[model samples]
Target: MSRKLPLLIAIVVILTGSVYYYFTFRRGSARTIQTFAYLRDPASRPELRMNAYTQCGTAPFIFPTDGLVGFIWDDSFRPGHRHQGIDIFAGTDVGVTPVIAAYPGYLTRQPDWKSTIIMRVPDDPLQAGRQIWVYYTHMADAQGNSFISQQFPAGTSEIYVEAGTFLGYQGNYSGDPNNPVGVHLHVSVLKDNGFGKFTNELEIENTYDPSPYFGLPLNARENTDTIPVCN
Candidate 1:
């Protein structure tokens, strides 16, 4: 009886550990795990790609770039860290995938910004009378060399760009050359400050879920398992 009890105890411990691992790692990072799988085989998902300036279903905004959406808005990397935007992995070498404007607006690239741009939408497409800002970043190499188009230079502001306008290419700039991110585009829909400028984009509260804009399930919390694709 004593030997049988010991075996039973060991089995219970093993089962408990397996459950803990699934809930802590697998379930918690299901989206991220699936993203890496898609990155390895982007061609497997075709519904996500369409002609530039074309929207999926009733989405107001067009697909900004062709790639597998790796991460999504509100995705948390750790405790108290919420991702502010959706990361579209190009699944190609840096500067190979082209990124375009999702909608028409006044584009601005700060003077010190090496791989970032912001577009001001006078009226939010989802909400009338409310202004929003479309922010794009990671358009640079690890060394901070810009990949943005020559048409919009540093300090360029208030330039009206049409939807599908060539903006730049994706890169792996993580601000630190030693720890460069994967080649991808991080885009967010930012809330406009009452002063007619964009609010802090790093904060989750200042960003909007891109689902309504792109008409896809771009929120990480909602979609897990597979890459987001239009039905």
Candidate 2:
């Protein structure tokens, strides 16, 4: 009887160990399978294009025709904050320089390029309420005429701009040229999702800081051959 008891105990221990091993292995395998499934899902793909092109023009140190001085935060504009966009120096000397689209997308023209260009990226999935938009201002004619373009004021219906397509010219319309500074292309980006998109609409509306997106400085000087002719 004593010998039989040891045998029976050994059998029970073995069975218990086997059961533990089975459950442990099963759980680990299940986790691995779930991870692989998540990786295979198409919706989890990355959105940013590393080598994508910008929607602005390619000219020899010339101003973008989209005439813009800088951007002002909506909060800054309301009361005593007093803020504005970063103005890229587009000297009055080079008036009406052709502005081109930085990237290929649908163009939403503002009353003036002075402050907005919403670009819905071609194949990017909707990021909730984050839509990319660019803004430019401080536009004027060679004769120094500065006024918000008469075409569209609040917003326009639709305008197609291919990469490098002409938009408009640069000028010093934001304020007097000499009082504080000269004309410049104030470039900025705003993201919108449309739902409660009204709040926090402009994400990174900084001054002409398109370096990360376009791989160039705000005032990049391209080769003469690439520069467009003044028309």
Candidate 3:
């Protein structure tokens, strides 16, 4: 009976571990599972590619994270509401998820409304210097307000960043500080309106389809891809 007592205790320990695995690891959150799978093989990620090809142009923008993501570029979600930018959803979100600088450019922060970060990338790299703006927004804060100013209070002063610079974590601040658009990042590209100021992103018409903007695999399906983002 003494020998059997030790065996019984071992069995009980094993059973407890199995139960924990079943509840905690094996049956993890949906986002957690997706994130893991995405890191293992990114090209198989349909959630990130759902409307990436069909709707948001054939350009597959760089997968910004090893984390699982969902692309919401189609503004058709609501009538009369033209979403000018694309929203990328990350896994079981925490506040620290890094939003990478999509291109090598100068970054400036507008501490109004959504607290937008605009990157000015070179337009005519081969010729005389010309620049274009890539607008990114919804940087997260518990207050649902300006995280950019809190981090770098330099305001609109230009700060140069490379393609992989740590822009900030995913944000959701819209206009009201109390309400966020959710845990995600919104991005758009802008064209100069010829008056020395860029077109407003709110117009939808002013923004370019981000699909062809970043070095996305535009129209090239069947390629599992990866991109270098910030830590």
Show pairs that collide, candidate 1.
none
lDDT of each: 0.85, 0.40, 0.54
RMSD of each: 5.6, 21.0, 16.9
Judged by lDDT against the true structure, how good is candidate 2?
A: 0.40
- Cα lDDT tens digits for candidate 3, 1-231: 998999999999999877754443322234344545764565676444322222223322344433333332323333344456655555335365677766677777765534567877656232245556778777756465454534445466578876666666776666666665656667776776765466787877786655454434221121122321212
Off by over 4 Å in 1: 1-28, 41-52
* Per-residue lDDT over 103-184 for candidate 2, one digit per residue giving the tens place of the 0 to 100 score: 5556665453443445444332223334455555445533335433444344764565566555555554544444533444
Candidate 1 whole-model C-alpha lDDT, 0 to 1: 0.85
| Superior candidate under lDDT, 1 versus 3 | 1
- Give the TM-score (vs. native) of candidate 3: 0.59
Q: Which has the greatest TM-score?
A: 1
Best by lDDT: 1
Q: List the residue pairs that clash in candidate 3.
A: 58-219, 59-218, 138-171, 139-171, 140-171
Which prediction has more favorable TM-score, 1 or 2? 1
